[model samples]
Target: MTHRPLPRPLNFAAVFLAAALTVELLDELVDGATGAAWPLVRQDLSLSYVELGLLLGLPGILVNLVEPFLGLLADLGYRRALILGGGVLFAASLALFAVAGGFWPLLAALVLFYPASGAFVSLTQAALMDAEPARREQNMASWALAGSVGNVVGPLLIGLAVTLGLGWRAVFALLAVSTVVALIGVRKSPSLSQEAPTGEKLDWRDAARGVVAALRRGEVRASLALLECANLTGDVFRSFVALYFVDAVGATPAAAGLAVAVLTGVGLVGDVLVLPLLERVPGVRYLRASAWVTAIVFPAFLLIPHLGAKLALLGLLGMLNSGWYAVLQARLYASLPERSGTVMALGSVAGMVSGAVLLGLGAIAQHFGVEAALWLLLAGPLALLVGLPRRASLGSR
Candidate 1:
């Protein structure tokens, strides 16, 4: 029998970009809005900084726990269902968050929301990978760019909404509408059907074994460790940067929101500019240079005391930081065989674990000061350097 080549990867960039933007809108509505309103929320709710951190961190914990199961389901050929279902659940969570009156209600909503987000993210990447296995690097770069665009747009939109006196609840409502629209976009896209078939049923135990086997490989392990470090740094900044601006830099809520918007917007630009250049550069060399740049720029946030100087530093940080995800993700895809869903899910799990640890550290640093928290950010790049071997042979093409 003559074998036909697979269809070229679906040009789901528009769908993916729309969905990613919606997801970011929801995320910013919940986290970014809350961060900007931290002072007001703390005063109104009579909550401590530690409690706020816990509330924010809960999503990470829930998402990590549920991701492996979602990944298993995707591998079992339910990619479309998982993606669509996640979108629905994410929308509902945002609605719940908008009306949530107390801490418990907010926490419950987050628990529902984040797992769905994780599922959607994993399945979306899997779908893209299935569509164009040969062009995995380019596609993954595009995927990262979509996320960067979302991050940029989400914060700026929410900031505008808040500035217009729409309040945080209104922001959530807008985000819910955006998610529904994105869901429609996703449904219109062609269904993906390139996953490996599971001849017999496989349990979580089987999946766990697969994960263990993958991690046991030396190069894969190194890559995972490096990714964990990157994740920790990113999560730490995302979770606390707004608070730092408000409390440490003496900025108002609107100003803090603008700072975040600027960072994300510049980062989006960086992703678009960097994607085309990846092919011309050696992946290993690019990773090394990006890592060093991140390491240097991240700590500089500590020294810049003036608001304008800090914003400038953040833009530079955004430029360097934005490319890291695409580079790392491309390397990750190159390292794995065909288990894109499984690999991406496992990577998410690693990132969540790192997020939880970083949040704990953030809580501790909150007691001391944001300065100490900045120090914690330094640990990530240092860890990345230590975990990654000096030799470049370990990374896959």
Candidate 2:
């Protein structure tokens, strides 16, 4: 007898994914605007590189500390309030961000905005994973794809902001408006408990033990290390690329915006292309090979003196870098399939160190150049080469 495929379930997986994507798109637009307008912001505020890095990073400390707790709460079934309430707060924060005029207010806004949005990011991933466990890899890829779409809109939004004389604040304003609409849909949607019903109440003791246990797993260790490396490199690039375009290459702000757009736009394509291969190929192989390729292309991208040449190389680099997260994150979930909530919070924990990295990069840029600071990104591939498991499958275990 021939095997017949089971029918796909009618659930809010699609709805939740849409809400998640909307949040991502809105967040990236602001991110793109900030990066694209960095030089302008810097000049306007008469800020130093150290100040800028601190401005961008110091507010993240509180968020990082509470992240695991938030994850644990989500695992305990707070997805509805976390998603809906957090999104509205996230939107309000963005709207507040528009009115922030000086360094302190700006810092406050970052503090409020990141954690607020962090809620959406962490919970949505948990909910979506809960909603469809079997399709973890595909769902992770879809998540990235959605973020990539946001990435594209980000620079384009900034580019339009510059063209229309709307200024950087406009990006935040638009994101706030868009986020309100997204939250409305999110609020109306069925609770995640409807699919993955509430579990036992969160036990901090159990969570602490689970974390210790997770840390001991060689697979978890490897994946988290790779994630840390990936986050560093990607963060450095995102924070610096627009500055590189305008500061080093003398590109216009609009041109810088487009350059960021191109970098992420190519990444979007790469993510879409890999969704199918993810099922057929060993994720580690792709992750490893992509790492080597990105490492190779990255320096050449720096060496090339021409602005156009660098942009072309960045697109190639974007394509290579795009595969790291999907495959690595999939492998991550596969490592401890039950702890999607935990995996969502690991980045924030790792992010605790990123401020220091950004500070060092800022120092380097102040003393030498942004390109010299960017050289630090080599740590990403180096970590992959040493830490990522050599197993034939996605997870070494």
Candidate 3:
């Protein structure tokens, strides 16, 4: 029998993915600009490193804490409403940050902002998975590339704002506008509920059961652990890389901006290439090899002596690190076919926990030195390589 491909209109998935990326980019811009504002904020508000970590890491924690509930909501045919509400809340949070002048207000705003961002990310992934069937790998690659593009644009946009003599408050205003645009795009998106399974009310108990089920399966547990480790390492690097360049490597903020641009730009290339390569290599082999390579190449940052060399090394690291999320996400989505929404939500929880731990490590590094912290970061990939599943299948349960 001849099979016909599913109807996918006007690349709606791509458009939806792009809108999601814009929100992510705006969030990143806020994150980068706030991090840059730390020196000024520290002197003015008497902020300590612990407080800084709290401001930066708290959003992620809140997001992780709420992800499971949000995912379950999406599975119960509430995907569109959840995304719309999340977008509105995210924009409102950014707007609040625009005028928030002191420490407490900013911290409170982040608690709201992070969960909103988490809802957008988790729901968007679920929507894309629901939208595409046969081209899952390709669609996952596209989704990842959208995020990589956001990462590249976020720091660059912040650098431009800094160059224009815009205050940090102005950056938050700009992010608010971006979120509003994303909200509009999301509203125009087709309802994912049309494609979802019917008559199945998600059980609240399944959220806990999903966690227990994932842990009991060795392959699923291994993949989740690897993601947590990699995410922790990446978050720590992101948090400290700009500071390290300025204080340790003797570069200005603009120069640090350029290095970040290069790092994330190369990562975009890695993300774009993964889908095509997936056709040639099995998922497990590709993941195992990528993990090994990243482990070997990531620590090479310590060997580079000059600013240019360090920037180049960061770009190389970006290429290896960028594809990790897509590969891992594809695997997880495949592993829990009937419950992808739940599984993805749990992954977000893991990322949140890992981010909190990494933020603490980042604070320690800030007080001591980045070089001293590199040793601990090196352990992440090594642990992944050791714990990685040996199975060869892409989505084998």
Of the candidates shown, which would achieve the greatest lDDT relative to the real structure? Answer: 2
Evaluated at residue 373, the lDDT of candidate 2 is 80
- 1 or 3: which has the higher lDDT? 3
Models 1 onward score TM values of 0.77, 0.80, 0.79
Ranking by lDDT: 2, 3, 1
lDDT for each residue of candidate 3 in 1-397, tens digit (9 for 90 to 100) = 9977554554665576566556555655665566556665566678888988788767665667687777777666677787788888888888887787677887887888877876765676676666665445666666677656655565556567668887556777878887888778778878445323545565667556666776688767766877777764565566667777877788899998787667667777887777678767665667678778877777777667777778888887777776566666677677666566677567776766675676678777878887677657777778767766677555522
Please report the candidate that would top TM-score against the real structure: 2
lDDT of 1 by residue, 1-397 (tens): 9977554332455455445444444554455555555555566567777878878766776677778777767766677888889889888988887787777777887888888776665676667665555555555666777666555555555568768987667777767777787778776666444445456666667666777787788767766777767765565676677888988889999988878777777877877877776667555566667678778887787777888888988888777765566556656666765566677567766776675676687687769887677677777777766665554442324
Give the poorly placed runs of model 1, Cα more than 4 Å off.
Answer: 1-54, 101-105, 162-166, 188-191, 197-205, 238-262, 295-311, 363-373, 382-397
What stretches of model 2 exceed 4 Å from their correct place? 1-12, 36-55, 99-107, 159-171, 188-191, 194-200, 242-261, 302-309, 364-376, 390-397
Backbone clashes, each candidate: 1, 0, 0
